[model samples]
Target: MSSHAPRSPFRAGAGAALGAPALAMGVSFLAFGAAVAAAGLGTGWALGASLGVYGMAGQLVLLQAAGTGDPTGATLGATAANARFLPMAMALAPWLGAGPRRRWLALPFIAITPWAAAMRVLPGLPEAARLRWFLGFALVSWLVAGLATWLGLLAAPWLRPPLLAALLFANPLYFALLLAAEGRLPASRLPILAGIAAAPLAVLLPAAWGLLAAGLLGGTLAFLARRPWRRGGG
Candidate 1:
């Protein structure tokens, strides 16, 4: 009788696959923590937000609202900022492909970076290993983000505005580069172009509204542009 190697739930490549995105998220969260500290929210609250909310945009919204001393507005703002996750969940549903309980449990780990990384990596992974890899990747990413938040909060006292601005800029730059890496696809071009064209106009709108508008317009244009190609199988 021949024996086969036992199946491993974890992939050797899983940890390394998300290293760059995890580092980028850590830096972004470091900036976020500094911003929160500068706002006088303290490290505990910042770390708590990292663990509980795990969303940079929503945390920023909460901080902004707290500054205004408006609890209701803060709640609404955070909700609106996090509204993007709903569509994100829908988009990821097919990729996750598991029992409801498992997918539901993993929902908290969903974020822009993880979603993008998973989209790029999961297709190549066996179905059984995908969830495990995602969970492991997300855990490491979350820990890095949380630790960076703590360090940033501690270092906030010494950081200057320009330095903090540069730190904050890293996240967007990383995301832009990620998108550019994927821009070889015809479907991506129209949306990227639309977003660029819409940026100035978006800036004139309220912050949340502006993001929503740009995404909707850009995504709509991309969808329309892709229809013909998709139908033609080209």
Candidate 2:
């Protein structure tokens, strides 16, 4: 580890959290808990989704699919929903340094919130401190999610249709805001803007395919726009 590394990067990471993204994730987990209860699954199932699946979109899909008595399909759907993380993890790979830091223990915690935070700040940090910082941020996020799930399940009986639906919608909406903010980076901005523009078109496609289509189309356009010949034009 470099001497420049903060002795308490993990603590610093912990302190960096409990913020807006955490709040958003909390709200989403609340929705997940409510969904769990509504799906006729119990408290353990809700907590399992939070601690295990960890991804909100995947958690919701897991709940729905699990209810259908098709475990294999449920697993596949949930796995597919969280496939976005593969790229995110890959992007963070270089910052994690070598050996264990590049492996399972730290990588499991790379959720959207912490990943975005890492992109904003990790480049400025000591390489030795980066994983600790991410671990700290991610642990706080994980706890917030778990607590929120408990509360939401407790409140499930009272939350109604429109409200529940609205809560369910909140996570993805906030994720867009995260992406828009990430767009401040010159490399990420064009694709993010393009994705935002293509979002409306996503509605015209099948629910599952829409977002995927929007992302691929948007990212492709952004990549083209940034080509050497089209540099200033982008």
Candidate 3:
């Protein structure tokens, strides 16, 4: 029964993986808010985008579209930017536990940071603890990002352009580093290599489609390359 003692998911998850990514997410959202303000949008608009969209890439696309005075393009761009979430959700489903209801409840929080953190940590946790840990980690990250967005909006008047740009690049840089760390594994090597090869080529594609193309092409190539090894292992 001692083995079944209650554990604090919040503490566990936070202690394990929430610190750096949460800070990176907060900085990224701060940059988003600053960008919105610099583009002449109100704080309320930035807050609304943060709350409703909750996607950094999509929010950036929306900001660009709004700046260009193209609402329709913004909508389409945001939608396209968010399309990556579908695959992310699919990849996370198995770890999130089995139930339509649970997945529905959890899917809203399935952003890149939380997903990556959960994926890195969940395999070692007991099955019973995985979902709770994920929820706790995601909740803290979401709250931190929202708060940082608000703060950034308030501070935008005093922030310099270069500093804002650094903030904007923070999360993506962190993510790249995380991926680099993960690439130490044999299976991740091929996918990382393929992505590196495809990224420059993908830039030749239309707006917002390049990332999608790069990911699809890279992932497909990686899967094909890994198949024989997987089959042999099986």
Best by lDDT: 3
Pairs of residues at least 3 apart in sequence or in different chains that clash in candidate 2? none
lDDT tens per residue, model 3, 58-155: 88888888777788888888878877788888888788763657667676688888888887877777776778788888878888888888888888
Q: What is the C-alpha lDDT of each candidate?
A: 0.77, 0.81, 0.82
Provide the lowest-lDDT 10-residue window in model 3: 97-106
The lDDT, on a scale of 0 to 1, for candidate 1 is: 0.77
* Sliding window of 10 residues with minimal summed lDDT for model 1: 5-14
Compared with the true structure, the alpha-carbon lDDT of candidate 2 equals: 0.81
Question: Which is the better candidate, 2 or 3, if ranked by TM-score?
Answer: 3
Structural similarity to truth (TM-score) of each candidate: 0.86, 0.84, 0.90
- What is every candidate's alpha-carbon RMSD to the true fold? 3.7, 4.1, 2.9
Taking the tens digit of each residue's C-alpha lDDT, what string does model 2 give over 1-234?
Answer: 897885588888888887787778888899888888888888998999898888876777778788788999888778767776787788887776536635466666777888888888789998878777888888898899899999999999998878988887778788878877887788888888898899886699855456667877887899888888765655
